[model samples]
Target: MLSVSWCATAQVFSPGGGTGVWRVFLDPIRPGGPFSVTAEQRIANAVDRIILKDVYFGDVWLCGGQSNMEMTVLQVINASKELTLASHYPYIRLFQAGLNKSLRELNDLAGIAVQWSVPTAEILGKGNFTSFSAVCWLFGRYLYDKLQYPIGLVESCWGGTPIEAWSSQKALSKCNLSFNVTNGDQKHEATGPQEPSVLWNAMIHPLKRMAIKGTIWYQGEANTAWHNAEYNCTFPAMIEDWRKAFHQGSEGSTEIDFPFGFVQLSTYHHRVPDDSFPWIRWHQTADFGYAPNPKMRRTFMAVAMDLGDEKSPYGVIHPRYKQEVAYRLYLGALAIAYGEAGIVFQGPFPKYFQLKNSTELRITYSQELAVLELSKDIFEIRCCTMWNYSSCKWVSAPIVDNFFNILSLSLEQCQQKVSGVRYAWKEWPCNLKKCPLYSKSSKLPAPTFIIPKNDHL
Candidate 1:
């Protein structure tokens, strides 16, 4: 019997006009032709098509977060249209890593790992709710169309999981957080997801070696309602640890410190006096600005403060408008990842505030980032009647200066002395279509913001 044994690892351009060179390891025609290198779990399944000719090279993104990030195509607002359209895009590849928990970090998955799938009507329908991450998909779709690259998305998410579970114990230790599992009150130890670093140990540890462009996250709901205050420190720490862990290896040549983009919690219809979400958003903003690394890529936020479903029952904590959520994320990716100059990815956040007088407060920001459109009634400036959540009501104020891009809020006319001013911070079905505060260049809506009480008259 004669056998060809000319085996060698080679990298070459893909079958179609792909973006980058693909690696081809000739293994006696045993390990199929083309497939995404599994992130968490190495491919442990079989495929019908032995010869995968339609290989492409592009960016692979780790789409990690909670339920919202895990929300599937069938669950999005425009499911039928979105799913129908998803069938057409063949270049976008998805690896839905099945869930498995471990007490310690492992090199590979222990359970049956699902292989990669390129979306089509049949394949997508088969996967159904487990098809792909909606926000991640839409984000990838946008990137694929604009950047014209083969996109791979790693779907790693669990509903109702906290940031604590996703973080590593090493990271938590560095942050100096107390993880005492008590019985009286903090007995969250009873829950497996709350166990410090278990999720990261099990789900994320194996993927440290995988190559990729960056990560897109949509979590923080669980952390908001309780541990809101800690996000300012923990969130940044988690990112830093992730950067070090993923890029950690004997070879220092590989750079894994990648750009991270995440969604700010959408407006919640919390009728109660809970400021958890607001404080969480505040901490998130602070974390981004104050990340430990100065040279690493900066984290970006997709402000969804105005996107929360405001309909009755208040059960719609997870908004169905995934299309816009992804659109906003795309704006960030284009500006940060693709290096498109002059993109207003960051919305008009208050850069500086001045106490002009006793009855007036002034806001200063970059003109390029001023996406606010008063003409469209997208932005609503509210004067707080009391120093409380949702106590502010919409009020008209002069655009003190547009050429200079300054906003002045006059408290003299208010019957109640204004404690603070909020921008697009309504609780009820917020100003979705008419959201006023947006970036002038990127057309991205501004996140909810409130000046400090010290700034008030």
Candidate 2:
């Protein structure tokens, strides 16, 4: 065996007190001589030993977002068994990204140290609830349970931090943002700073070299509810950044695209009645199939419209039933990421729109079904109060489809008087039964459409 050595620097919090250096030493290997392993295998062994520890090294997930992303097992209901089952998998590990928010370039300790870990009963029982995304944790759990592969989760997020706070001053300066951020008692203003991409810089950028299978996002509550800006460009920017960072060899040569998946924000509580909230959700839903990365060339968004309960406490911050959220995210990963067959990843979404007769709106969608007819004829539309999950109020739904049996709408009803027509728009979740594409009622609403009320305005 020929002896070779290399040094990798890592900062580890000492169990006794302050931080210390973690020096990684690569063992000797034969030089141009016989080891049963192939060159690729040898390199992989080096990487596994030098970089990640206790990780399976196959597929890894970068779980991101705000408080939702940081929500963990202990706080969730009945999470003990779930986490206990998760801990058995030696391959699955969770690495927490230590929080750091500063304008300066972050040093090496900015990102999470590892990919992910299975939670132990002891860990769950102790219930630190310090730094984990509840929805993200469950989602990773689902992936580990189904794939039975080594899964790693890198969590980088902060609670109550808006899109602006997460962005760098440099990036924020370029964009026309609207939020006011205070840096050391001095307030700086911009149009909404590019969302998410900011956090990605401090928290995620350092981890770029690490091999990852995909990312699971649970943000948008802050950006959508707070900024309400058109995120079409910013959301894709964040995705592209991740793709460029992770989809390369050390030499920066390979053009690789892993699956990028995210969860749409579930409904939350609101006091007053309002419509049109779904427009932002529409933007998020559109991201599933729409946000194309020119580099990696693929993106996906998991639906959470159905995940929220109309009955959930109003104005409450965190909602339960994360297992379902995890399972659906897994389904998206299974079908879109890992190439599983026969799974429905999303319901019908509006793809194109046209105006006919000046009184109706024509819409085309990705999924085809007979529900357009049902929604028009029966019109048994139900309105959900944020306070009532067990029941709903019946309302009239008109035949909204136009021209192509694809989608028809009443041009007269939605005519010049309608500012915008939204399918399901609310801060909280809604239930639509027997939707055209979904076999069962979904907690989330179908993809909503936005049309100007005044035609010429």
Candidate 3:
């Protein structure tokens, strides 16, 4: 085990652990409450080896993912209100971790002491909010106010990084993921996050068994180079490994299936985008439906299909509308993590499709909702070639039944094969104002997906 030897000069805490503050690594194994350092040893007297004590017994969340997750609170378009408001929450803590590469798993975070400080307002001074993760800070602020508990955020994220970097070697091997970025070109070192297990060893492994409630991920923009089909297996494997890591070490958790939530990819226009980007969104949704373990349903997806910034001719992959993303994550956390009653967490999902006739098909969703304008949001037939696709013209699905929540589509009108039918399957489907479909109960838009197999009538 890798341990750090350091001294402390932070504020002292009261004996009873009242409304106050302390900055030190408290004994994580004690049950009754957070306790002070159990033991300490001097190292040659040159180094003051003291295991400091901190007593913030709140839930910690591992905010892990890539670029989008790295977006700061200052970047939000109308973020002044949030930035100022965030400074008031002293209970909310931030433990910022930087990027590092490792050939083997690491037992501690790289660099200086991993202190839990408020990311906003530096202890009575205005030294926070300059580096807080926008989505994460908002989520934590909301949750802290609601639950009234100390919320610690461990940000283990890197820009343009792929999911494999945060995953364990054992997990990747189990899923047959053998991509080694080290063997590839060395000149592209600054490209970020394609390498596997590097960030996990340096940033994540150090936090193992350091009690966290769950993780909130906002990534997948960088993984377009990897096979999209493989994401269905790789993503879950990563989540499972993280849960295992969180349960290892001295402060391990018994709950294997820790509640995990993620922001589904948003709409964006890139000069040269990956073909598998859209499919990755489908796989994210598919995990909720087809995970090998039923408990994986605890995994929730915050659909950003309606939040893509499409006005820009070139398109904005990183949309400034982080408030909606945070809200959706709030809804997900409220329902999935907190198990709130009478709350709507999920949007409309394809329950199943039934064949009504040879040309027409009936589509039903898991939730019931009023069918709105579909002329722009949805496409009926599959477009094979660009020339044929442009002229093919998408035929919108008409509202069939409000009670059953069905949208009727005609296969004959599309003049394409019946092998595939999907909605908002494009890389930038959210680039439009009118979303494909929405639920009456939740009002959330329909997620992007290609119907598995040929459900042709």
Using lDDT, give the best candidate's number: 3
The true-versus-predicted C-alpha distance at residue 349 of model 1, in Å, is 1.4
- Point out the worst 10-residue segment of candidate 3 by lDDT: 121-130
TM-score per candidate, chains pooled: 0.76, 0.67, 0.78
Instruction: Summarize candidate 3's per-residue lDDT along 1-457 as a digit string, tens digits.
Output: 1132232223343566364532344444322223344333233454344453554567777787876777776655575766677668877878777667776677766653235775553321232222557788778877887887677777777777777777877877777876455565333332444677778878888777576778899988776665467777778888888887777652455256778989888866543334476788867655443221363557777778677664522227677677778777877888777889887776777777776665666777778865665453355555333344343433444343344577676555544444456777667654443575777887777777665344342
lDDT rank, highest first? 3, 1, 2
Note each model's CA RMSD in angstroms. Answer: 8.4, 9.7, 7.6
Question: How well is each residue in 1-457 modelled by candidate 2, as lDDT tens digits?
Answer: 1122232223333455445533222332222211122111133246322332232344567777667666666656576666666556556566777776543444354545333445555533353346455666677767777766656677777776655555444444445543333333333332222333345456665566666677877767766555555554455545655576566522242136667777666666554354334555655544332333242255665666555554433234455566766776777788778788876665565666565655555667555534523354222233344434344443433665433226665644322233334454455434423333332233322444343333421
Return whichever of 2 and 3 wins on TM-score.
Answer: 3
Candidate 3 Cα deviation (angstroms), residue 348: 0.9
Worst 10 residues of 2 by lDDT: 32-41
Query: Can you write out model 1's per-residue Cα lDDT over 1-457, one digit (the tens) per residue?
Result: 1112233333343345444523232232331224423212113363222333455556778888888887777777767787899767778888766677666777665543346778764434344346567888889999888876578878777777888888887777666764543223333443766566767877788777766677888888888765677787777778878877777731332255677888888866645445677677767766332221252356767888767675623247777788888988888888777679876676666677665665555777655445345332223345565555467665544344354456665545555545545554344324565465556666666566655453542
* TM-score, candidate number 3: 0.78
Please, what is the whole-model Cα lDDT of each candidate in the order they appear? 0.64, 0.52, 0.65
